[model samples]
Target chain A: MESRNFKRVYVWELPVRIFHWINALCILVLAITGFIIADPVAILSNAEASESYWFGTVRFIHFATAYVFFFNMLLRIYWAFAGNKYASWKAFLPFSKKRWNNILHVLRIDILLQNEKVHDIRNISVGHNMVASLSYIALFVLALVQVFTGFALYADNSDWFLPDLFAWVVPLLGGDFAVRKVHHIATWFFIFFTIVHVYLVFYHDWLEGRGEVSSMFGGYKFIREDRLKKTPGNTKEKSEQPSESKPEDNPKEDEIIV
Target chain B: MATKTDTRETYYESIIKQGYSRRDFMKFATYIAAYMGVETSMIGQVVKSLETTYRVPVIWEHFQECTCCSESFIRSDHPIVSDIILNKISLDYTLTLMAASGHQAEAAKHETMEKYHGDYILCVEGSVPMANDGYCCIAGRSARELLLESAKGAKAIIAWGSCASNGCVQAAYPNPTEATPIHKIIKDKPIIRVPGCPPIGEVMAGIIVHMITFDRLPELDGLGRPKAFYAKRVHDSCYRRPYYDAGLFAESFDDENAKEGYCLYKVGCRGPMTYNACGTIRWNNGVSFPIQSGHGCIGCSEEDFWDNGPFYERLTSLGGFGIESSADTIGKVAAGVLAGGIAAHAIAANVSKRKELKDRNSRGRDNEKQLDD
Candidate 1:
């Protein structure tokens, strides 16, 4: 008989979770409104020009959502500094050799579907895996590009001071037409990222048999008790470095006979 | 080399000699003041400058461009304006306007450059090609050589059109000539870019009046364009802006909506992105512009507008793709393919998941039997 044990670990903080959902909603609004603005749909309204303002409404929604998205991203950056280890900005960088090894192991199991027998217990992360953290950083940069080009395009039409600040971006990027092209293309990058992101979340939940999807909704993840005792190669250094134990010399190579 | 015209005839005396009455002169002065977007009180200042200033000793240079700028300048609604600006300004050295040709014209140009050094306004009407020394030449010297010499001794350089302001069509994609705008070549001088295919004649005259009245360059934007004229986009001041806001657009040039004066955005009007004074001041004496004539703006004033995309296409097609594919098309195709892949992967994952669960159940039953034994 085998014993199966579970220990609930608090992974995502409330602020991190809030940032995720709000950013998702903002992206959804921005994509739809952005497309409509780029190629407006014809509405058959017999009323006077003043009576129907669908295009204007679409643009206003896009601009409003853009502001919300910008501020939400700023809040997430602030949280990265103040939040716990799991949510900290440090998690995004694949700085250590062990972290790189874990990333390769994850790629093999999840993407290539190889080396299923050697499912290293070190691969189990209580929070975002290295891959997800890195992708989040990329998404943050893409969001910034959108804000800059969007506000630059709007600066001439808008009465606000913030949009005016980005006016210099227009000429810097070789004029309005080129900037519009870049802004439009970046919108699709977000859409593609969203599709891949959702699929991977569901796949990871199924593969790990842990509260991956639900952990985003509720901040708890079910971590194995045995895996927590023997810290991963990267984290082992942080826990007391004993003089006699040379775990670093030959990192735990034993495989469970399931 | 002293071409300072021993006769010191100011612009007022010259215009008066050209048979324009004093009343006509005052009307022209007030009209110019309005065109410059200056205060009505400054009309006296403009009139005084014209009466005293010694024509500013202009040397209009032509390079790799059509003479459309000169044509536009001469076609101002006010005949006195064209006459005074072209002839009365002591336009000592212009290839197009000057009666002297050959050695006489060459001598006249050199004389002005020498005599009025640091006092002349060098109005460059075209781009300078830097490839192979230079493709544009005047009187045995390359355009680059002539420009450097003229620019060295000039007070200010006014880039007269899109050709001189940006590289225009000559500097478009795959430019073999390596045509460069004057400002890019000459960095030391204040180069005011009057950027249109050929800027409005009144606007050209207005800039000259501004310099003469204020004794300084007009306030310039980041691109070195006069802010008063280029600050607002055509779409911002356009009469058809209401139509754009209301989601109304002309399907084509000959469509019912176009005839009704709806916005031309759909048929590829660059008005939204283009910043020029076409909508407010208009062209041809405030009579009509491209939009009013039921044609979309080609964005001629914008930098590298020719390479941006097809004149009629609304969106610029993504580069590195075959000519027809735009960003939207490529993105949609990619998304569609990714969606299909995700669906297939999910289905495969489900089938494998079920097989693995069944295998695990059988293994668990074997384990139970072993435990019982």
Candidate 2:
């Protein structure tokens, strides 16, 4: 193996890491509880009905976690504007020409597996690749759908003003049954997303040797020094050791290596 | 048949003339007010309105229906309710109740349509068949024609049951007659939908009494159902809700759980999704509803409920994926296919990576040999 100079770049901030883990945990809880609520288990309780409240507890957990999930998404959206470039809303939306090009590049090298030669360092992204960022955007939309449908269904039983605001959603979607169906189907989407997301994270971690998995945890990723130098905005820091460059030192230079 | 009378009588005069005492009239008013979910303090106002308000002429038309709504209406718990609503209100044009037949009944309906104009209420008992140029007809006129003519000069329309409100069973899958609910046809009118298979007897009476007392349509929900009755799901006020909260459910009709009056959600009670006053007001004067009678609610009040079910199965079956396939089945199949594909891709990736590494290593050796030579 040839030794290559690497720069430890801070990519995911502390809030982004917190949001990622919290969002992951919330999705996990919401999916399980949501499915259970949809088709409740027929537990034959020989004890008095008043003595047991298991299904109610399950529903309570779902509703409670839903609040957490909703607020976590709001926090992530807030951070998208307030946080660094890596956590910015700009990264999530594939609106720019370069982002679209990166999406195609990722499709060829990672998904389609058309290129079997030694991996190109230039193709590796220091932040989220366009595909990943676009998927996150899709997930964000899905999250909004779940929130709307879930709250709309909850409105029937709740007197809270917040849930009441979603009352119009039920009628708009046709009825309660249709809303439940959409909410249930969207859960499958989350399940599919989780499967693909975890696999790609591990696959990229193994292939890139860039701490893709740990970056989500410790908020740092090791980028090749050459790739960092090639990045357009990082030219001012070219003479300095790339490892010594901090995002805070030059907040204006969003050194996104795609 | 009696001809069109020269003078119209107020509700109080009509009931008194029918041999009902003042106390009976007050009792009827209080009973109707309570059923309409009116405040106790407002009971006197209801009595005052009934005493002063003239009986609103009602044009009851039957279309594509089983006449169950008429049956339910006549059987209202307070005998005076049915008597006053049916007999005193100048019911004008119901085929089942009116003594006049053929042209006489038709004449009476037209007379009220002309005489009262915008002051009369049009009560529809069934859906209108849109297929085959209005398949359901009455007195040589299509239901749609009669409905349109009558609705043209009505104060407000009352869709009596699920048949009139949501097309009921006839509007189920592959609706052969294309039975459409009244609201679809008469978009201009203020339609109050009392949607049950045959909405509760008192509910039918309460709606009429509400209009008579308030001289206006009751507050309605988004679906045009009276918020007083359709505000809460049957499950919200169900007697068996405790069992549901406790995770106690009847697995089958004959199960011990069912015998013990456990929740019928497992056996396909649609109470959670169905909006109506069944759990509270019940049927037959608050005697008992379907859930209390050991049968799951068929969600009779909901739109297209017939298409929503097999009546005994839970809500797991998604209509989009065919009746047999549930969300769980579709989800599991998709997940399985994805897992298989992912496994195959992982193997292919590993094999290709190994081959690429071997090619790189062999090429490196070839370069070394060339340098040595």
Q: Write the per-residue lDDT of candidate 1 for residues B158-182, one digit (tens) a residue.
A: 9999999989999987889999999
For every model in order, the TM-score on chain A comes to 0.86, 0.88
Best lDDT goes to which candidate?
Answer: 2
**Segments in model 2 whose C-alpha atoms lie over 4 Å from true places:** A116-119, A230-257, B1-6, B320-322, B355-373
Model 2, position B240, has a per-residue lDDT of 97
Docking class of 2: acceptable
Worst 10 residues of 1 chain B by lDDT: B1-10
Worst 10 residues of 1 chain A by lDDT: A237-246
Candidate no. 1 TM-score: 0.90
Clashing pairs in 2: none
TM-score, A chain, model 1: 0.86
* Residue lDDT tens for model 1, A81-197: 998777778778887776687688767666655545554555666567777777888898998899899999988877889999898988888678888988999999999999999
Model 1, docking class? acceptable
lDDT of each: 0.82, 0.84
Scored against the true structure, residue A130 in model 1 reaches a CA lDDT of 71
